[model samples]
Target: MRIAVPVFPGSNCDHDAYHALKHVVGVDTAFVWHKRSSLEGFDAVVIPGGFTYGDYLRCGAMAKLSPVMDAVRRFAEGGGPVIGICNGFQILLESGLLPGAMMVNESLRFVCEYVHLRAETGRTPFTGGIAPGTVLKIPVAHYQGNYFADDATLAALEERRQVVFRYCDPSGDPTAGSNPNGSARNIAGICNERGNVLGMMPHPERCSEEELGSADGRRLFDSMVAWLKEKGK
Candidate 1:
């Protein structure tokens, strides 16, 4: 499968995502600049982590207006799979492609470390290969990674099974202490109502290889590719 990784000024993790998909996951991938208004020929798109637009006007707020994001919104509306990591998740929220908003870490500090994520559901393409309640070791790097939503929104997400992952202890328990950021309900990741678009704060590309201390993140990419192939056939 072919993947497009959109690159914006200050997008530091674009290359890492490209490398993970191209070399580590053995998929065709390309870097799509933020100014370009096309996402043609790509089966999936990844908005990688980084401080976009220098995190000005709030994280992802400025980047959401980029020309490429217009195309990305179109792609997602057409049911094309889209995954946003870290600041990218913030962009999705800003663009109205996903729910909720990001807040400063409750600790008021930049958090850069590996955390365990429990797969809440396997219904979405991004997490289909992962079994429910499975723990994944992934890294998160962001200052404004805390996720928040209204009670009604959270209830709807739970009802639709759109909450794909949650911050959890190594043993798979989602508790207050395990939440790296003060996200509502310990949510680490979530998908849209249609299940095609996903937004998560963790950096899956950083740990897609065993040499990097874990290969658990590969399952997410693999699941997306597998779903694409299945749909194509």
Candidate 2:
């Protein structure tokens, strides 16, 4: 299966996503510019993180207006798997592909470091290969990674098992100290109700290899592959 990594003007993680998919994970992958209007040949889409449109106006606010997002919406509507990381997560929220909005890090500063993420569910394509409660060591870097939603919406997400990951300590306890950006309920990632679309603040590509000091993130990518392979059968 082939993967598409969308590249916005300031998307620094585009190469990182591409490298992880094509080199580390041994999957066919290609870069898709933000102007492109189609995702026809791709099996899955990964929007890498960066300051799209320089995070102008608001984080991902301008990016939601880009032409590529329309195609992404259509692709996602058709049940194509889509995963967005960090700034990409912001874009997904702004574009309405995912629920919730990003807020400034509770610390009021850009946080850049490794944190543990506990898998909250394994039903989604992105987490299917991982066991529930598995802790992944991934890095997150952003000033607005905190995620928030209305109490009703948050309740729905929890009730439907849409929450996919939560920031946690190594032992897998979601606690105040383990939350890098103070995301709601220490949430680090979540998926749409259908589980085809996911947005998260962590940068899995940054830790997909042992050389990067962790391979835990690779399980996420590998999980997507496993899901696709199963469907293709």
Candidate 3:
């Protein structure tokens, strides 16, 4: 599998994401520049975390207009898999590739640490290897990770089972301590209606290597690769 990791100004974690796939997962990976006009020959793409454009003009507001986003939108519409982490998730929201919006942490702080996430749905390629209700330990670092959506949109997400993951304790229970950013319903991640595109505030690549802390994130990439292979796509 080939994974495209987008690199824009201030995108410090792009290489980390690439290494997770190339070294850890042993998958073909490329660092795609944000100015690029196309995303050809890539099986999947990942928008890694970081302070894109120094988080100016809202978390991902400035990065939304980057040249690569057009290709990303096209790739997603064609049923290509795309994963957005942290700032990348914010970018997806800004790009309108995913629903809802993100706001600053309820306490207005930058949180950085390993967080527990509960798999809320089994329908997405990103979580194919993990059964529903599985617990994953991943790192989340962001100042604006609070996810919010209107009541109707939230209801629609629940109806379609698009809510893929949520902040939770080690026991997979949503609690005040497990909720990192005070997101509505403790939502940590979600997918589009088709389930090919995923946006999450947690950094899965950061924890894919056990030495980095945990291997919980590895299943996410593994599942995606396996899913693509299954379809022979």
**Model 3 per-residue lDDT tens digits across residues 1-233:** 67899999999888888888999998899999999979999989999989999999888999999999999999999999999999999999999999999988998999999999999887888898899999999999998999999999999999999999999999999898899888999999999999999999988888887888898889999999899899885
lDDT of 1 by residue, 1-233 (tens): 67999999999999899999999888999999999999989889999988898999899999999999999999999999999999889999999999999999999999889999999988888888899989999999889988999999999999999999999999999999999989999999999999999999998898899999999889999999889889981
Candidate 3 clash total?
0
Off by over 4 Å in 1: none
Q: Supply the TM-score for candidate 3.
A: 0.98
lDDT of 2 by residue, 1-233 (tens): 99999898888899999999999999999999899988888999999999998999989998888788999999999999999999999999999998999999999999999999999999899999999988899999999988999999999999999999999999999989999987889989999999999999999999999989999888989999999999891
Candidate 2 colliding pairs: none
How close is every model to the real structure, measured as TM-score? 0.98, 0.98, 0.98
For candidate 2, the lDDT comes to 0.92
Model 3: CA > 4 A from native: none
lDDT for model 1 comes to 0.92
Alpha-carbon local distance difference test for all models: 0.92, 0.92, 0.92
